[model samples]
Target: MKIILSNASSDPIYIQIVNQIRQSILSGELRAGDSLPSIRQLAKDLQVSVITTKRAYEELEKEKLIDSVVGKGCFVSGANKDFIREQRMTRLEEKMVEIIRESKELSMSKQDVLDYLNLLYEEEHTP
Candidate 1:
């Protein structure tokens, strides 16, 4: 998997790493039981501090998305895809609730939000 970092992004470096690695696993690009680069190796490759990579790995481990073995290195968790997807969906639902509340505060109608969502969804899907 290739990880690209963006200096212009608002998110911290570790977050960017975590997000991309999470996407890889979720998309099946990195399948269950697939071995990931070692923390030191990834740190050297990304030209980032070891702490950054460790933090990113720690976050993934916290989500049960990956597992680390003392000597073997980190690998994608063996959890079923449906379970992983459900975990992400739960998080998405929570975020949507916050967004919906904000939309209501701004007097944005349901249709308005739906239209905007449709546009955004289409934009993401468009080639």
Candidate 2:
């Protein structure tokens, strides 16, 4: 597991850590039962306080993306399909909102924007 922190980001260090780990889980990079680094190790690797790393891990546990085992370590949780679908939809809606705003500013027709979307989607999915 790799995490990169940005000192320039407006978000706190813990939030940045949580977001990256969440994204990894959602993207399937971190699968169910995959072991995560210990809080102390993560703090050392990221050069942040142990408290910050613990906070990030706690948030992940709260979201059901990870679980902590006593005397062991944290591991990725088996995510619920419905919850995953909801998260995907939420992210898609956010992107669509941005696309719609940009299209309106450019005076593009709805169909034009949709056609571009389809093209981009196909490009990404093509082998």
Candidate 3:
């Protein structure tokens, strides 16, 4: 699994890690049963506090998105694909609503928002 940190972002570090990992699982980049990096190793690699990574992992476990085995490590849960997809879409819609509200606060017109979104889509899909 791959994770990137954004010190400049308003979101907490642990939340960023959790959301990215969750996205990976939903996108099929991290398959069910795939083992995750140990907390200490991920902390070292991400240069974050062990507590932060641990909290993120614990939250994921609580959500049943991942399972921790004693002596073995944390692995992605064998969750149903349809369920995961629905959950992912719901989260995406919530975030999109937040973005739309922010755009409205900035007084962006509908056309402007659409153009900006198209630009974002192109950027994300760019090779």
Best by lDDT: 1
- Residue-wise C-alpha lDDT for candidate 1, range 65-87, written one tens digit per residue: 99999999999998878887898
lDDT of 1 at 3: 98
Error of 3 at 23 (Å): 3.9
The C-alpha local distance difference test score for the whole of candidate 1 amounts to 0.96
Candidate 2 vs candidate 3: which has greater TM-score? Answer: 3
lDDT of 2 at 105: 100
On TM-score, the stronger of 1 and 3 is 1
lDDT of 3 at 62: 74
Clashing residue pairs in candidate 3 are none
Select the stronger candidate by lDDT from 2 and 3. 2
Ranking by lDDT: 1, 2, 3
* Model 2 lDDT tens row, 1-127: 6899999999999999999998888888999999999999999999999999999999899878899999999999998857967976897899989989999999999999989989999999999
TM-score quality measure for candidate 2:
0.68
RMSD of 1: 1.4
Candidate order by decreasing TM-score = 1, 3, 2
lDDT of 3 by residue, 39-118 (tens): 99999999989999999999888767899998999999998878777876897899999989999999999899999999
Clash number for model 2? Answer: 0
lDDT for 71 (candidate 1): 95
